[model samples]
Target: MTDLHFLPGCRIEEITRPDANSLHICAEARRRSGRCPDCGEPSDAVHSRTVRHPADLPCLGREVRLELWLRRLYCRNPACSRRTFVERLPGLIAPRAQRTDRLATAHGRVGVFLGGEAGARMLTQIGMPTSGDTVLRLVRRLPLPRRPAPQVLGVDDWARRKGRTYGTILVDLERHRVVDVLPDRSAATLADWLRGHRGIRTIARDRSTEYARGIGLGAPQAVQVADRWHLLLNLRQMVERWLAGVHGRLRRLPPTVGQPAGPARRTGAFPRSQGERVASADSRERKKALYEEVRRRHAASEPLLTISQRMRLARGTVRKYAQAESFPERAVQAPAHSILDPYLAHLEARLAAGCENARALWRELRDIGFPGTSMQVRRWLGQRRSAPAKTTPRRYREAQPAPVPPDAHAGAPALPSPRQLALYLTRPRDGLTNEERSAIGRLERDPDAAAVAVLVRRFADLVRGSCIGGNAVVRAPIATFKRWLIDAQNSSVSAVATFAAGLQQDAAAVKAALTTPWSSGQTEGQVNKLKLLKRQTFGRAKFDLLRRRVLLAA
Candidate 1:
């Protein structure tokens, strides 16, 4: 018979199909003598024989299984500990492994790239029958290669369960690969990891105090650099706080020409009914009482937890009230149900088409199953018509004065919200839209807002490394930043003063952030990747599996 050499050093004896999806390839080892695994001595003395079946890679679009006949050989060396050992094929498979090395490698790659159930489906489509659990096991079994100590490091924490538990990921900033993952974000855990791996020159991190302390304790020689992005983000947050404090001032400012009034202003603070006014007054009194109590407790040096327990409020609510400089106004929620909702779109379409007759619109709605009365439609149409055409440019002829609803009046002049004001203050002038520019102009009308705006622009220029000039650009120096921070601290803006204090606390890191270009931006990107990997496991995977996937896959 012609010998069919299927696998290396093995001959195929027979082939059979146990099922339509699978093919069994029976084979036997060609060598008669086997080596003892422990003693490494050749032995022809066969004590027993057995047949081992292991899965192999798919062949010709069918799942392949190998049935190999193996021998149990007796150890010939008298001094050897083992009396007998199983014959092993080192290149074909590992000891007691269920699959060949080549097949395991393919599964491992699929597991690393696609992850578990998705990988199993992909492998099944390619004629490899395996479960999601098996794919995960293969991935977890892969060995991690030893990496050299990183010269520059980036550290950040990722949530295993957001707001509850987190893990720290340390990356070699130079190579941009994750070096290790610690089980917790605690100072002790991170410090331990850092101590194990030395030779770090610089550590880039966020403004996390725990990480800062850990780095200081573990590697005092390494320079700590604060991330620039976090610094800019802190600036934006401070600006928002400052705006929040002066939001009432923003409302008092007159609206600019061509600026469309917001919904709040359009509904200009209509005179509330007696009952509505009574209810609002009651709500305000209750909130003010709570705010005062929180502030009093905070002034007495009571911690947030003690205040929360004493007041019978959640800690988060207690913290908010304590931190707030003034009692927060109750946010006006929009009416949930409106009679005009169903017909408003049609009315706008008609108005856009120059159809302004309320009676005609009422008749049209009645034909379309509108159950509302003509008077209700007329009142709504009157409000829309009376609203100043800030957005639309078309001219309209005066029509009959439709009766206004008791609840409707000219809204307060439209003004930008605090958030929009903050964006206008921080973003580049070139990026602002015409409306935003107009809003900025309106804000600058207030002397206080204008002073704050100027400081914001100067700080932004210093951070960006350039300043606007009369047809010429100029470089901003670090000295300018130092001077600006001093000015900000002395300024009347409480948010800016608080921000300046923080900069002073970490003066060295902040200065390094400005002078040196190194940053934790790469660490942020790796965190995004880590989020993707965490999601791939459907959030059920433990740390060991997650660590292997991140390190080995990289």
Candidate 2:
């Protein structure tokens, strides 16, 4: 209600509410004697019509705003040779700021946290008028002190657009915050960041050749520990890649179409599914049809190999079919009969001897002429256990399991296998419950599950076989797993074959990691968080802001 208030060194002259939500105030500057801020001259002539500002009280339980207006008079001193100057205002604004001090403070704080565009949106929500660019300017204008280099540093690379532009970020691991961002994840840039730190003793980073070189150059004495999460992630990716290679080979074969479902047979070759078998058959049929045209030419007296070369069919495939009894009479040899035949006898002997032991049988086969390693053997055995057992004799029945039933446990397919369970257990399962795990376990163990049950049992055996400090020895189960993966008929064998090559490539590291407590748990969590952030940002992210948010949030 009152316009003026008395103070020791300053006076507030007037106050008025221009609108219900805003206040308007006018005040006079009453400085006794001071040099002009603009002209730097002592004792201004009456610099006419000046308004002073005091820090305003909080408004609507939110922010404070202030305004100041002042004029400069022409300096009347000829010898001093100075123009008119405005009164100096310290603790309020720099030389030229359009908004009041209070508003700028609000923008700075909000921009730093919610970012420019987001801050603008939030400010509107809170009844303040602001723009995204204004908030961004506030961020740029915020005063920050030059910081010293951190001792324990972490380095990582981020892609602006994957495979296009990449940037490197340095974090003070102790502070758990990003300190700086480099133009690229190159040895030169990273090395420069490290060179700035005189006291750096250790750096934690991923296994990047560039980063390693940079660290070596920047801080030769710093010990680099490969980030454990990255280690696990690289390992997992490597394994997945190996599996994909086998998948490529399998794709070349046609899918098995309308093939009779039965207990899967044991073949030393990689197992293919009914779908895969159908695919393989389709491919062969297509090839066969093409070959028929070539064969017609051959029958018409074109050279045998010449027909094959023209059609692009293997000469061997043409020769075998050409020599067959008849087109309808001749059977296509199973994709991998050679691998299966030698081991089939051993499987029968084990089952007959009441051994019921996959590992023993796998070992027996390995001792004979099995081409695949023990892991391959174990995968094959696991598939056999998980697959549906045949009512027919072991010699002829194929190992295809029944379809999954409805009303199965939540987050589990109707026909879940132990291999799937093992896969799920390795990663986070947000939707799966304990009941789901048990249900899957039950499915894996069910006699109806066949080779799938074998898979579950093999997983259990591997878990049990984990030992302390000795050789981390490969037990009979591993050999069985390998055998199952190479087997053609076992349903679970497909998954095993896919995972085998990767496991073999880094078999040593993987075995050690599995045997030890190290895992990809943290890395997977980070990947999930990254996906969420990527979705939230929606491709409009600035590298600086994204990097800041990740480092700070972590």
Rate residue 183 of model 2 by lDDT. 62
Error of 1 at 441 (Å): 3.0
lDDT of 1 at 77: 96
Q: What tens digits encode model 2's per-residue C-alpha lDDT throughout 517-549?
A: 323333334444544544455657676555544
Q: Which stretches in model 2 have alpha-carbon errors above 4 Å?
A: 1-10, 51-58, 62-81, 125-127, 241-554
Model 1 compared with the native: what TM-score? 0.77
How many collisions per candidate? 7, 59
TM-score top scorer: 1
Candidate 2's C-alpha lDDT? 0.53
lDDT of 2 at 373: 59
State every prediction's TM-score relative to the real structure.
0.77, 0.50
Q: lDDT by residue for model 1 over 341-382, one digit each (tens)? A: 766678878988887677888999999988888876766655
